[model samples]
Target chain A: MNKVVLYMSMSFDGMISGHDDGPGRGLGVNGEALHAWLSDGGISPGSHRPGVGVNAEVFDEMMQTGAVITGRRTFELAGGWGGDHHDGVPVFVLTRQLPDQPAPGHARYVTELESAVAQAKEAAGDRNVLLHGGSAARALLDAGLVDELVIHLVPIILGRGRRLFDDQGHRARNLELVSATEGADVLHLRYRVVSR
Target chain B: MNKVVLYMSMSFDGMISGHDDGPGRGLGVNGEALHAWLSDGGISPGSHRPGVGVNAEVFDEMMQTGAVITGRRTFELAGGWGGDHHDGVPVFVLTRQLPDQPAPGHARYVTELESAVAQAKEAAGDRNVLLHGGSAARALLDAGLVDELVIHLVPIILGRGRRLFDDQGHRARNLELVSATEGADVLHLRYRVVSR
Candidate 1:
């Protein structure tokens, strides 16, 4: 089965994006610091910048992902990922309405989350389906569709922002820690979603 | 200087207590699972039962703490630590009103947070002053008084609860990860509070 994985960068306080995260800003106001580990020429597709430590490992893992599913806000905020999917993989955007003309990359829009995840999984084949954006990931986790959660735990605390898990009355879920690795400026935590 | 350390157990989603956290229930609804690591005859002052791994380590660390300061709600919810301190350490409860009579085992009440912390620090002497609750810890952190923050990161995700960093509009603080240790059911994370 193609595993549905929610992978994202988060602050030490568990904020996925800063308070002002929106269309113009990808990660919100001070959130750029959260991705400093990747700014040093790490794994960000096409740019095979020589990276070391956990950044390289995370890059290699992301490179192997088959399809990416993201929220409409994240897709728009990222400018449709610069007209191309991350490493040419198929991208599915979970949105209520689709644009008249789709962008250049292999992007698809779906009104429903389950169908978007299903289509992403089908597109991913045996490879892992990567869920991007905190809202998208939270939706998947709430639906019990996420098989794994990988967090790049940045060491900074953005005291106020959009939290990764913002569901007010969501159900409790159990996670088994699979691995914890240290990077230059981030802690990579991989957890298997045991029970939702 | 007596290091002021904010130490608490937190859920994976960063909640320090459950939705129904209050008197008679220390961790709140369904939060007992978070402290199962400490229930198996580990370090609890009088319990000298043979314990190994993280529970013992936490016990030893708690034993070394000279004084503890906590919020009024936490103190009341815990019933004044069952009428006694955890290990006979002087406990300063931050509250607006003082009780008619102080609880047993060196418990003191202070109307102000700064004075409570100061009294705890003074009582601690050269030893470490421990902040015992999420609200108390946040107050200290907001005041730039917390020198270190130690979290016992439990793996369960309580989707809805009182978060440790619930102070919205609070200043963003930086943290340096000093250590990360794995326990049976929790991950012990020690971070140096970098800035206010």
Candidate 2:
């Protein structure tokens, strides 16, 4: 079975992105600070910036993910993942209205979140289904679909912004720590979602 | 110099306490779940509850702390820390109005935060001074006085509650991760406040 994993970089204050985050700047203005650890390790294939550390190992693992599920806002803001996404894997975008023409290669738009996740899981086979975007992850978590969560606990505190677990009327869920690793500028924490 | 350390148990959502947090039920209804790690380790000398783990070591270190500084709200809500406090240390309550009568051996009310911290530092001598409560920690952070932060990261997420780093017009401060240790059910993270 394909596991659904919510993986993201979050500030010490729990914000996934800064207050001014939007289209041109997906992480917001200074939001890049949250990913400075990745920048130092040059882990993000999209940016091609220089960085070195434990994130390299984590990045390599993430590259093995077979499918990506995200919300419309993240897909639109990220400009459809550009040319940095993994090869041959489908990217499912959950949105109310489908795009007139889908991007080339493997991007698909769906109206309902459940079907999008289901389709993504089927496409992923034995590999993991990566959940990107705070809203998308929250939706899956609310539905108790996220099997794992990988949080890159950044060392800075934004003090305000888009909290990864913003109040969405979701009931409390227990998490079991699977592993913890020290990175150059962040703590890589892996947790398994305990099913109720 | 007496280092001021901000110590608190926070949920995965960054909340220090839950929505219903107040006197009699200081951490809120479900907020106690956050400290279940401490409860298991029996690190709190005041409670004497049975608990075992790395928290015991952390608790021993905390017991060496010479003083504590907290906001009026936390002090009042906790009913003045009762009898569960470090031995022979003064707990300064930062408030505008001094209680008609201070609690013997444990509590003292002060009108100014800075002065209260100074007094706590002086009273602490060579030992570390602990800053407790969300508002009090925020005040110290805003004033650029906190030397370090020890966050007991609990696995549960309380969607609604008082966040430790709630927006208060404070500038972003960088923290250097010093250590990360696994405990019974919490992650003990220590970070040094990098002052610019």
Candidate 3:
């Protein structure tokens, strides 16, 4: 009975990154326009790396979560930290390649999406699990692993970029509107996933 | 001098319409998602006719302008009432084929962008001018005709649709963020055009 939440920022366009497979081209830098609120609140911290001017509230929310899940491509792009572990949080990364060693403490890799979800649920204890990354997040949502969707809609349009939900064809997930608010350059909307 | 503003609600993927050119389908059933705010206010009469069910506030602000401009495609789609004139407001539409007859009153046909701007400025006689379509709006913005961009960032994120700004490369138009507020399922943001 654990909740899996998807929390991320997106542009008016469905793109999560400026360009696909283009380094530093993440969401066309136009995506950064959507993160102005997070940046202003110091919630996004320069890069995904923890520490440095990090927003305590946002960090605490992520840290207190039971486990973290991400896509292989997202992890790989993070270089060494792309594995299933960060800040003492047990990380479950979806991948096909077998790893030689554990990424960090409490980190592991899995080939099957369902296996990863079950593992993350076990590791979560009583805390809710957090699903990260674009593709995996969409997959998790499709598989009924997501309980809430927290989307922070940023105010700037990136004409083109990496699609966040490119393959969400014919999928319908009814959601209970939780809350909606305005952040600097973003609109924070929270929806509780009811049924898929 | 005329202060030209660009206004439109875009999709999450930055599309203005769907793959088809037919009405409703492009923006989605009478622009349901993008114009939810308008309907929520009991303003959307569910018809395309002008001066009907339009919110008094939206109509007042829009008409406060000196004149209005649109592309031939939009003007034609709007049917006869939306020619180059409306209630003493000079309307200029960008088109290769000129209208066969004079459009009622307070209207004239012109094909030049600059000429349209000049005519709009003259009509306002000290009021603002509004750009009201995709290509024509984009052209004005690209040509440094727009002075401000006031947008209602609707909440619905259509995964696919026509893009307001197509793939064509564009020059950055500096904007000074004025305000961002939450309204119904939309976020309204105002920006002053700083530099072209």
What proportion of the real contacts between chains A and B does each prediction keep?
0.85, 0.62, 0.10
**Candidate 2 residue pairs in clash (backbone atoms < 3 Å):** A40-A51, A40-A52, A41-A51, A41-A52, A42-A51, B40-B51, B41-B51, B41-B52, B42-B51
lDDT of 1 by residue, A82-169 (tens): 7665678888888777778765568877878888888888988889988888778877888998999888888888988988887467
Per-residue lDDT of candidate 3, residues A1-196 (tens digit)? 8877776776644556664345434434565564555546443544442232333345356667888888767666655364334556688888777788766556677888889888888989898788777888777877777887777665444656665666345244445557665544456566777665
- Candidate with the larger DockQ of 1 and 3: 1
- Candidate 2 residue spans exceeding 4 A from truth: A41-52, B41-51, B99-104
lDDT of 2 by residue, A156-181 (tens): 87777887887655667778889989
Predictions ranked by DockQ, top down?
Answer: 1, 2, 3
Q: Write the per-residue lDDT of candidate 3 for residues B86-132, one digit (tens) a residue.
A: 45687787887787876545556678989898888887888888778
Q: In model 1 chain A, where is the ten-residue run with the lowest total lDDT? A: A41-50
> TM-score of each candidate?
0.93, 0.93, 0.74
lDDT of 2 by residue, B1-196 (tens): 8899988998887888888876776677678888787667464475744356588777777878999998888877876667346786999888767778865457877888789888999999999998888888888888888999999898886778888988664667788999999988889999998963
State the number of backbone clashes in model 1.
0
Best model per DockQ: 1
